[model samples]
Target: MTVFLIRRLMQAVVVLFVMSLIVFIGVYAIGNPIDILISPEADQIERERAIEALGLHLPMWEQYLVFLQRAVTGDLGRSFAFSTPALELIVERMPATLELAIAAMGISILVGIPLGMWAGFRPESLAGRAIMAGSILGFSLPTFWVGLMLIMVFAVHLGWLPSTGRGETVEFLGLQVSIFTLDGWSHLLLPAFNLALFKMALVIRLTRAGMRENLLMDYVKFARAKGLSTGRVIFVHVMKNIMIPVVTILGLELGSVIAFAVVTETIFAWPGMGKLIIDSINQLDRPVIVAYLLITVSMFIIINLVVDILYSVLDPRVRLKEMKS
Candidate 1:
């Protein structure tokens, strides 16, 4: 297990390095920030100074090397638009994004697993059919549209929830969290539900598929032969086995939710990293854009590594295979 973990960590490092290079080069290629930073009426000397200050005057390779070195030392550079450290700005908004992601994942797991189990257990029932139909809509609808419809229904027409914003927050463990407060939770519900819709559908399908496959396996039949209660056999024996795949998907989806919540955040006006990234992109803030990409890529790598390690814990056969390899 230790050797396997080490191997995965090394692979993660390489992936992160390649991702950083791609992000750096791609962000630079988007456009010169100096064009936006410097005024239209600025003279040639001012333009030259601005370009030099941003290290744009240096050769691309040289600039990349400098960036790599600074990044290694945790210096991601200052945002041209915000006049602040890119990393600091991202960190400031990390809590909000994390809150939303966690809430969304919680909703997905809590709701999806049971619905999936029910559908798998009674696929032909009316309720199961209804759940499957809803899952289809969940997968087919666009996120933005879902978010808008949620707002129109819950916020505009019913007035049961706020349409936007991360409502009042109270500090907990040195971080401000909204869920602790009633008003804040009311604000969080709609967006988190909107963000979780697709993931919930995906989890339901995967879980249902896994449950169906496992229910017919010899071990499950043996457990039933042993006179174990149906509930215990299904919930304890089958659910545990089915969770391996579900957990893997949840881990990857969690990373994606954090990194790609831009549309949901924008539509809901949530003050999170996704909204910040959108603003940075609009302003062509190279440092912030590159930093966001690197952070997100690193998150994906880390989550994937964690999921791989979790596989060993959840299934001994996985660890045995890794050792044999």
Candidate 2:
């Protein structure tokens, strides 16, 4: 297990290194920030000073080295647009994004699994068919569109929820979180639901498929033949077996949810990392852009590593295979 973890950690380091190079080069290629930062009528001397200040005059390799060095020290540099530490800005917004992602995933898991289990057990029933049909619609709808419709119905028409922003927040453990406050939760509901729709559908389908497969396995029959209660057989025996895939998907999807919540955040004007990154992009804020990308890549790598570790824990077969390798 230790050897396997070390191997995975090494692989994660390599992946992050490659990802940083791609992000740095890609951000540089987009367009010089100096063009947007300075007035068009700015003279050559002014342009040169700005370029020098930003280290743009250095060779690409040298700039990358400087960036890498600073990054290693947790200094991601300051945002050109905000003139603030890029990491600080991102950290400030992280809570909202995290809250949204967690809420969305919670919705997916809580609602999807039970419905999927029911559908898998009773595929021919009316309720099961309805759940399947709803899952299809969830997949078909776009997040932004769904967000808008939600805002229209819940905020504009019914006036039950706020349409935008993280509402009232309370400081918990030195971080401001909205989940504890009524106003905050009301504001959170629409965006979280919209963000969760597709993932919910995906979970439903995956769970249903897993359940159907597990239900037919010999152990299930054996459990039944042993006179175990149907509920115990299905919930304990089937659920444990089916959860391997669900947990894998959930881990990976959590990363994606955080990364891809940009659209939903934008639509809802949520004060999160996604919204901040979008603003940074428009202003050509390379520091923030690079920081965000690197952070995102790191998150993905970490989540995947966690998922791999979880696989071994959930299934002894996986642990044995890793040990053998």
Candidate 3:
């Protein structure tokens, strides 16, 4: 297991290096650095001075090496547009994004799993049919459209939740709750649910399909013949086997949820990495862009590594094969 983990970690490092290089090259190819440095009416000497100041005369490889070295040392440079250290900016904004992602994933797993289990067990029942229909609709709709509709219905029409912003000035349990603080959890519900709707449907469908397949396996029949309780045979015996695929999908989807939240964050005015990325792009803030991309890639690599480790623990067959090899 240690050997496997080391191998994966080395692979992740190589992949990240390549990602940084690609992003740097792609951005550089579009324009010269001097263009950003010089004003429209700048004289020739001024242009030369600006060029010298920013090291535009240096080779691209040298610049890339410098960038890579700084990145490895956790010294992502200041944003070109915002004039703020990229790493520090990201650190400041990360909590809001992390909180939103956690809320969304929690809702997806909680609602999707039960709905899927029920649908799989009673395929022809009205509840099952409704779940299938809703899942399809949820899966098919565009995320932005769904977010807007939710904002319209829940915020505008019903007025049950705030339209945007973290929360209002209020007291909870005799404690003053600030919108920018932990008390903001109340304002997070709509955005979290909106972001999770598609993921929930996908998980439900995957779980239902896996459960149905497990239910038809010969071992399930044997369990029934041996007089195992229906719930035990289904939930205990079948569910474990069915979870292999579900677990894999869930891990992959976890990263995707973060990516998709970019749009949802913009729509709902939720402060997150997604919104940060968008703002950075609009301002041509290279450092922040690179930092955000690196963070995103690292997230996927970390999640996938965890998934691989969990697979070995969940299934002895995988562990045995790895050991033998």
Candidate 4:
């Protein structure tokens, strides 16, 4: 197990290095530095001085080396557009994005697994058919459109929640809380639900399929013949064995849920990395863009690593194989 973990960690490091190199080169290739270098009012000498100051005359390789060194030291440089440290700007916005992702995943897990179990139990039942049909419908809709519909229904038409911003001003536990923090939960209802809808549906379908397959195994029949209750035969005897693969799918899906939340965040005007990245791109804020990409890529690598390690823990067979090797 330890050896497997170490091997994964080393691969993760290499992948991150490659990702950084790609993003760095891509940003550099987008345009001439002089476009941002020379202001409209600057004279020729002044423009040349600015170029020299920024090392625009250096070879592309040399320029990339300098940028990479600074990045390694946690100095993403100041944002030209914001006049602020790029790292600082990203950190400030990290919480909102993380919060949204976590909330979405929590909701998906809570609702998805149960629905999946039900559908798997009686594949031909009315409830199962309805759940399967809903899952198909959900899988077909775009996230942005779902988010819009949620806003219209819950915020604009019904007035059950705020349309935008985290929440209304409120005091909690003697501390003043921002709407996004306090009433923010209320506001999350629509966005989080919208974000989770498709994920939950997919999970339900996968779980149902896996459960059905597990039920037909000889061990399940043996458990039933041994006088085990139907529930026990299905859940304890069948579900446990099939959960290994389902867990892997759930982990990978969770990582994707975070990655794809960018679109939902934008539609709702949520203050998260997604909106920040969009703004930075439009302004050509190189530092902020690089920092955001690094953080996001790092998250994916870390999540996948965690999922790999979990496989061994959840299934002793994996750990036993590792030990023998």
Q: What does candidate 4's lDDT look like per residue over 35-98, in tens digits?
A: 7645788898988886776667788789778888887787877776777988899877766676
Q: Is candidate 2 or 4 superior in TM-score?
A: 2
* lDDT of model 3, residue 158: 92
Taken over the whole model, the C-alpha lDDT of each candidate is 0.91, 0.91, 0.80, 0.78
Question: All candidates: CA RMSD in angstroms?
Answer: 1.6, 1.5, 3.8, 3.4
Please give the distance, in angstroms, between residue 20's alpha carbon in candidate 3 and its true position after superposition. Answer: 1.2
**Clashes by residue pair, model 2:** none
lDDT of 2 at 243: 88
lDDT of 3 by residue, 109-200 (tens): 89998999899999999999999999999899988899889889988999877767666435544433333444376588888888889889
* Residue 40 displacement in candidate 2 (angstroms): 1.5
Question: How many Å off is the CA of 58 in candidate 2?
Answer: 1.3
* Residue-wise C-alpha lDDT for candidate 2, range 40-87, written one tens digit per residue: 999999999988988889988899999999988999988998889999
Across 110-209, the per-residue lDDT of candidate 1 in tens digits comes to 9999999999988899988998999999999999999999999999999999999999999999988999999999999999999999999998999889
Model 2 spans with C-alpha error above 4 angstroms: 320-325
Ranking by lDDT: 2, 1, 3, 4
Worst 10 residues of 1 by lDDT: 316-325
Ranking by TM-score: 2, 1, 3, 4
